[model samples]
Target: MKPAAILEAALYVDDLAEAERFYGQVLGLDLLAKAEGRHVFFRCGDTVLLLFDPKATEVPPEAGARLPVPPHGAHGPGHLCFSAGAAEIELWKKHLEDHNVAIEADFEWPRGGRSIYFRDPSGNSLEFAEPRIWSFT
Candidate 1:
């Protein structure tokens, strides 16, 4: 057997607060958890989006730390897409524009779904697309 599903996805940023506001306020994801200067977490449907500070995450966990997650991070922008339907894609376009977030791209996928792309404050590429872009129901 193989892995069942993705439970979490992570993106790295230099500023935790800015990332927090962008994902929490602009994108309107509910606050799940946060550790000042280290990371911020948000709930998106059944999965968790983890935004971490590169500086903090690159430093290995302290001795005796409750969770000894090893050092992990990325330098440049990463991408994450939210599942949205054709109609919801239109609503998201307006919602993001209302929040002053520019839409970098908007188009229909060749296979038969629509997608709109943008960026977060930390410059990570973001997208809202129909799950059917990958043929998901």
Candidate 2:
């Protein structure tokens, strides 16, 4: 199947300290930026997971931003979900388990769908899934 639009996204956190503890310390997301209580950005490969609190600091819009910008970025539980294959999924699970990260749920959906769910310190539900492939009847 051809690629469509953005399948992944990110969210802001109420507490940067807590977010860093989970997403960085636990989940192993590389800390892209750490500006005190402002926010801590994580670089998840091509995508990004942001932990910003409005009470923190304000980042003014860049008139000539290089990357494609989001229209309405400052909002609620941004919901950044990632998709992976079987091998990658297993590896990620093992890594998270090794770090003592709690698993919210792990199940195989109807028709071969597979997924695992977990949350960061800020309590945002994060999931990694594999879509089921079905043949025509």
Candidate 3:
């Protein structure tokens, strides 16, 4: 079977409201749905981004209990990446820079195109990569 692409990524944050403000207002993700104090969902192209409160207690038993967030400076692999064309990448770079978002780096691959790295208010590493990264066989 072919590998299925990721449909969504759930980030456990200290506050869902803050996540909504950052991802929705700051980063400008299209808000698709939300449940107060529990979670918020955004539409990233065809994929979904789910933000949840780390302290929320409404999860089903089968979903397990919520856990505390890791202390600062402890590294983790949780991140969300967006794919864009070269022009779209530039547009996002300008938009982010104009909004005073700190850019971690902007790098180009040997193949073609480039990427920009940044973080959300919750410190989740977000990457916007050029779609051409996958164009080559």
Q: Any idea what lDDT model 1 has?
A: 0.92
lDDT tens digits, residues 18-58, model 1?
88888888888999999998999999999999999889888
Candidate 3, which segments miss by more than 4 Å at Cα? 57-77
Best-to-worst order by lDDT is: 1, 3, 2
Error of 3 at 45 (Å): 1.5
Model 3 steric clash total: 0
- Across residues 6-104, which tens digit of lDDT does each residue of candidate 3 receive? 887777666678889888987789999987987799998778998876555443334443644333222343677788877888899999888788899
lDDT agreement with native, every candidate: 0.92, 0.70, 0.77
Worst 10-residue lDDT window, candidate 3: 68-77
TM-score list, all predictions: 0.95, 0.65, 0.77
Clashing residue pairs for model 1: none
* Residue-level lDDT for 83 in candidate 3: 86
Sort order, TM-score high to low: 1, 3, 2
What does the lDDT come to for candidate 2?
0.70
The numbered model that scores best in lDDT is: 1
Enumerate clash totals for all models, in the order shown: 0, 1, 0
| Better model by lDDT: candidate 1 vs candidate 2 | 1
